[model samples]
Target: MKWSEICIHTTNEAIEPISNILHENGASGVVIEDPVDLTIDRENVFGEIYELNENDYPEEGVYIKAYLPFNSFLGETVEEIKQSINNLITFDIDLGPNQVTLSEVNEEDWATAWKKYYKPVKVSEKITITPTWEDYTQKSSNEIVIELDPGMAFGTGTHPTTVLTLQALEKYIKGNETVIDVGCGSGVLSIASALLGAKDIYAYDLDEVAVKSTELNIKVNKVQDAVKVKQNNLMSNVSIKADIVVSNILAEIIVRFIDDAWTNLVEGGYFITSGIIQTKKQMVIEKLENQGFEIIEINELEDWVSIIALKK
Candidate 1:
């Protein structure tokens, strides 16, 4: 069987949403090649080795690849994906370059091409994300491991945005606290909350694939009893107050829910948000401040920023 490899050249800010688009359009797996990874200092802690070749990455922006079976409707599907990506501009998402290309490959090639991009990596002080196929053992007593099969879904649990959120969760989530994860892709934040001793976690995502993916991941991490996965648009219908609310989504989407988040948090609750690029950092800060949130901490990794605010 033949497969169609759809490759998109876009900005880091658009990676999560575009990956979701490919998954919803029936792509089996997605591969991301960001030029920034070439310069990341991997000290190879815990004997983990990284094999990255700089030649494969684009000089600027990033390349996102997904595989779909070559079929009669492949062209139509590709066109729809392009239109949907172009539509992101309406939301003020910078899609940098936005050049898309396609190629044909054999099924065998498609099966193994994306595996090399994924490896076990420790994202935070206590949290380590490992691909389901990778063999890794905990190197320390306090290390928490999250096993995931990204499977065309966003949030591999290793992105800087996610890493910052998980790190904050580790620090802020006291035992038995009620937590909410907005735009919970793959349930990584929710799962990390549970692992950190949160008594109850509510995970919400506007995307159906994300909801299902979160459910699957929660079960994989054996935290199904602690985390509840649901499909909801931000906090539109959510009324339950939480001790901590974490959202790793676009800054624009985060701003839209500032009021909702403030209303849904108890006094002194923490609202953690990521997936924000550096340029929009001040915009998000002002919105949070206007909503009466006290800035607690602001974290930056590469061009990504994660803001932690307190509802006081």
Candidate 2:
């Protein structure tokens, strides 16, 4: 029982796609260490404090780490991951140094190493995401707690992109509205929607692993009846009219489905988009506007932007 820890030195803009490549290559779990966390100011509105170790982070670029089982094909797997990350450059993604290194660890160490990086995080005014292995007490009567495992999935529902989307969902969803979640990694948004009183939800992902992960998380949250999980490309052939269409993915992918999102949303319905780097934020905004969506709000966290628009 041994594991190979693959660490990639890359920029913050490359974290999402690189982590995705690792998961698709059968990595068990992914961990991100960004130097910005060492000095970034966090608002205490949610009473969440971070205790980060400077030694664990890179001085300039971010570190994207994933665990792969030690096996005969480990070398090939690592090569494929490297090539996939390099291909990201074609999409205009910055790769920084792109230096990759590996280390060996026992199964016991690998299992517990990533856990230290995750904790209960208050993402929005009413929503707090906590790992299943952690015990969290609600701070108020109105607080909502989401227990997530994020096993072999994308994130623990505490990433800035996810937090922004959850906050937008909390603000827009009144109650009992149908929600369509595109690129629903870890099912966090769909689960949050159900907790926010969404009546019916459709969660779709191009990756089968993501679809399965979403299904498992939905059941864990006891929202199985509210969310229907499926494996599909971004909004392809989706004809259901929804009150809210939410997606947290690359800005490029988000722009590709702007038309589909506009068509699937009912009049005055909302569209929430995240996972957008600051440079591409304006591009997504223009695409949404061209699709006849009225830009409602724009919010940013740690250089990640989320936009909320209404189909008017």
Q: Each prediction's Cα lDDT score?
A: 0.90, 0.91
Supply every candidate's count of residue pairs whose N, Cα or C atoms clash at under 3 angstroms.
0, 0
lDDT of 2 by residue, 78-147 (tens): 9999999999999999999999999998977756667766778888889999888888999999998998
TM-score of decoy 2: 0.70
Candidate 1 regions with alpha-carbon error over 4 angstroms: 1-104
The residue pairs in collision within model 1 are none
Clashing pairs in 2: none
Local distance difference test, candidate 1: 0.90
The candidate scoring highest on lDDT is: 2
lDDT of 2: 0.91
Models 1 onward score TM values of 0.70, 0.70
